[model samples]
Target: MLIPGTHYRLAFTQSVLALLQVINAPTHYRLDYPDLSLILALVRGGSLARASALLKVDVSTVFRAVRRLEAALGQQLFEKSGAGYLPTTLAQTLAEQAERAEQALEAARIGAEQGGEVISGTVRLTCTDSVLQSLLLPALARFMPSYPALTIELCTSNDFANLSRRDADIALRLTRTPPEHLVGRRLADISYRVCASAAYVQSVDSHDLAALTWIAPDDFLPDHPTVAWRRQQLPGVTPSYRCNSMLSVTELVRAGLGVAALPDFLIGDGLQPLTEPLHGYDTALWLLTRPDCRALRSVVTLFDELGLALKLP
Candidate 1:
């Protein structure tokens, strides 16, 4: 019969040796994975210079990364062609796998970053000049102080910012239909009305819209609802002052330069509404974000706050 202490010692020694053997075993796949992004960029960009530009790295860095990947895989991933570096079948396969991996990694990273209890980090917001000036700015005054850790970057543009490319984290838009790719909440219906400076409204016959001096958006924004309404309502009328930005038009109108069709949200203290809230020109105001970005705590908080603010008189 074996002593209990001796038996225990024998078992412990065998367990440790077994663990060491498992630990020493060579992994089927290398833990030091190749730089997938560099490889993908090279394949996508087609040339060293192009890849360097795309990755924002030096050409030598791209060359070195490629060389390292080739050395690890023990194969030539690309061949020199007159057009560009032609990726081999193996390279193509690897690139495709790498893209999927990159997407997965990005999703994971976003999840980890946004999953925190505290609402923080920068939230990029995009909207039109009028909306930014009239509505969002005032709302942000109250909202910003509450979330001191959160920062907001506002981008004002007439054209829709690309959320997929990360042009903006959030978009406030007046549209009948928001982009299908984005996830959002429709806050409220925005109404357009003929507006003028208090002095202009008092001076002119408000009913004779065609007879009044008009301030219009520039040729670039011909599709603007106000432009369309003006085109329809005053067929032969030409604007006295044409401006590119709606904010500029508002300023001009407020200065009593010309009457303008303005959104209800933008008619501040100086401007007077000449017409009843028009029905056909109404569009819904939407707060939109990338599906992935909606998970972020800061984004969620801002979105909720904005919705609440808009509801207020």
Candidate 2:
């Protein structure tokens, strides 16, 4: 009874509406969650070798994990470039989510441990070579025995470690200005003194800093306050030896190569101080940690112990 043309148009309209509805409906895709730890390592380490080292896995394993993640998501998470595997936007988002989840898990673990009698966990601590050798190791030798179950992973480097990235649970830094995001206590001012090998001190006019052959930290430490102070005090005094590391500079001075500015803590039996302890050129030492990490029992215990040890004579 219906007109053929009108009926055809109505059916077509209805079909198009149904198609639109289907298109508008959210598509559900099942994805197998990739290993969150592997992803976090990749994100933080930024290279295959680095990720493998951080995760303590073989490089091929990381590659396979990345491939699996890509396949599961049906999208590339990272792109291979000349520098290394650069994470895509999606990868960054995924990494952020993983970090949040990790934080939540850590919080839960810490809470559960707090309810228990034993305080046990690993705490990663980072500091400069000088601090590690002169101060921290000795302190830990005594402090660690008190907590039988606690484990300490010590990392020594001259470069500033980013605590926010979980590079370390605790960091000891000598800085005039600490980063705003980090929460910590400024322990004390690290004093420095002009020092030379006993032989070198005997040979030169000990009173006249200018008459002595100098050993200075190289351009690697351009912003070092004591180095800058030395430059100002001895104008046009070219160093006989320039070393990249402060420890190397100290060693060179100890070898009677030249006189150099050294931290008070590093003035060993072989070296003699040319000047009394100098203060203004020194930087304040900070015991720093990320805000989220402050709650961890391991971090708190180490932080308190380090603060007390550093304050000691």
Candidate 3:
């Protein structure tokens, strides 16, 4: 005996009332995407300072956001112990949900960016100078022009970029153990050899390791394998030239300043190996990206491309 469309009207009224109840609910807070993202950052970083760095905000801002979120929810989310901000169970759950939302949004953004025929968006890459000069730049030069809309920012440094902070989208690193948080594949084995200019190699008695003028990494890199090798293997030998950077050491050796240990990739045409691959100095080169960033087209493309291009023996 209901009127025509009466059921539809009732359903619409019920839907509106439910929405109103949610809006009026005492537990409701004006939570936005950024607020949810902040929670995830806090949980991941475990401290105001770390969260600040991750979000590119100040510590004070993170602190205030935590306070605001706590006040809005009427529950404690984090415990400020001496170590750092430890997330409570509620905070952890919320962060997990937020992470899912973040992933969805990121996927949508990436889709929009790649909606066109050409893959678009910027990818930031970080690596050492030797890797940059020898491998990355050349590979990029050949293929990057295909994606004219895509931008690549290369940051060359020996130091590790803070992947947690999103300082770089991708990192090519030479390390025995890559960070646990980063997900990547080992591209190749990095081997070091005692190298010098061809002329210098011919001039010096390569077998008489002690008599050759040595170039060593300076105290800036106290733990450089070359430093330890020189100290342990050639105890009485003092370096005639000490350079702070591996790139500098490579250049000096190339310029015929003295014999120095260099990565096999860095020893180009003019250089000759005085010794075979140093046994204990070997490390694997890794192509790494944050788990969250690996899904982006640009990062994925470059990472796969580099992995293929630099699959050295």
Candidate 4:
């Protein structure tokens, strides 16, 4: 029997073909699958850089595609704007049709499972710098050697990558709830604690939290867990150091600059916890990937390996 969405996917495929035929007849200019796919990605992403990331191509390639498609169809598909590339009416319509076609094609590909050794191609994984250094890298070191020909790209950032837009194939995030659109499971409970360098902890009177120097998340990170926790728990106290990145804050703590709230997994080396996990500052570590990407062998392998390795014993 066919997969559950086979009929719906086939219907969309037929509709896209009908739309393409009509578009081609009047202009007598043939646009191939690549051209349409680029258009759809460009429209969805709204910029050359974003489109490039989604398509796994260079920015110049996306720019060149735009120029070529405009020349071929003799229509202005997009207009340059301060924000990014703004799609014109024609581009928007074409993109909608292309998107449906792309979805149908991907569904068919996933259905086939394309039985073969998945020995090549890069899989992009996104996560925070802290996660990269503390957890993911070690797990990857063990898992990557197994797939000799496969390459994995790491995109480290504080912001979540847009998997729906294909910014990355998979993501390892610390969150209470993963996005509904992505498929994944919580690996473990991530706990946080007030931490300081072991030397600093020993030098200072640990019981006197108010007397200790403090480091905190900067103004840019107003929503950071440490920000509110500091304000509420240590009222009227000011931080000596403020960093926008959690990794940077961790480094500052390691240097014995000041005490700061940090994830338990990240508190190692010479760091020591001043308190047990801070209440209301805990979240789970989640391994998430788009539903479409979950079908790919490379993604499946990495996902499974990470799930098995990262889960707390």
What local distance difference test score does each model get? Answer: 0.77, 0.75, 0.78, 0.80
- Which pairs clash inside model 1? none
lDDT of 4 by residue, 89-134 (tens): 8888888787656654554454457554444556789998888998
lDDT digits (tens) for residues 1-313 of candidate 2: 7684453344334333332332222332232223556766888888999999988989999999889766755667788888888888766765665555444444445545666555566788898877888778888887777665566778886665557678889998888898898899988777889999989877878898887889988888888876888878788788989988788889999999888888877889899888987667888788888889888987898889888988745
Better of 3 and 4 by TM-score: 4
- Cα TM-score of candidate 1: 0.61
Itemize residue pairs with steric clashes in candidate 3.
Answer: none
Q: Please, what are the lDDT tens digits per residue for candidate 1 over residues 198-305?
A: 888888788888999999999978888888888887898999899988889999999998799888777888988889877687877888898888778878888889
Candidates 2 and 3, the one with greater TM-score:
2
lDDT of 1 at 195: 92
Which 10 consecutive positions of candidate 3 have the poorest summed lDDT?
Answer: 14-23
Q: In the order shown, what is each candidate's alpha-carbon RMSD? A: 12.1, 13.9, 11.2, 8.7
lDDT of 3 by residue, 222-305 (tens): 877677777888899999999877888999988888898888788888998878888887888899999999679878988888
What global local distance difference test value does model 4 have? 0.80
Question: Model 4 Cα displacement at 299 (Å)?
Answer: 1.5
Ordered list by lDDT, greatest first:
4, 3, 1, 2
Residue-pair clashes, model 1: 0
Candidate 1 Cα outliers beyond 4 Å, as residue runs: 1-117
Stretches of model 2 off by over 4 angstroms after superposition: 1-116
TM-score of 4: 0.62
lDDT of model number 1 = 0.77
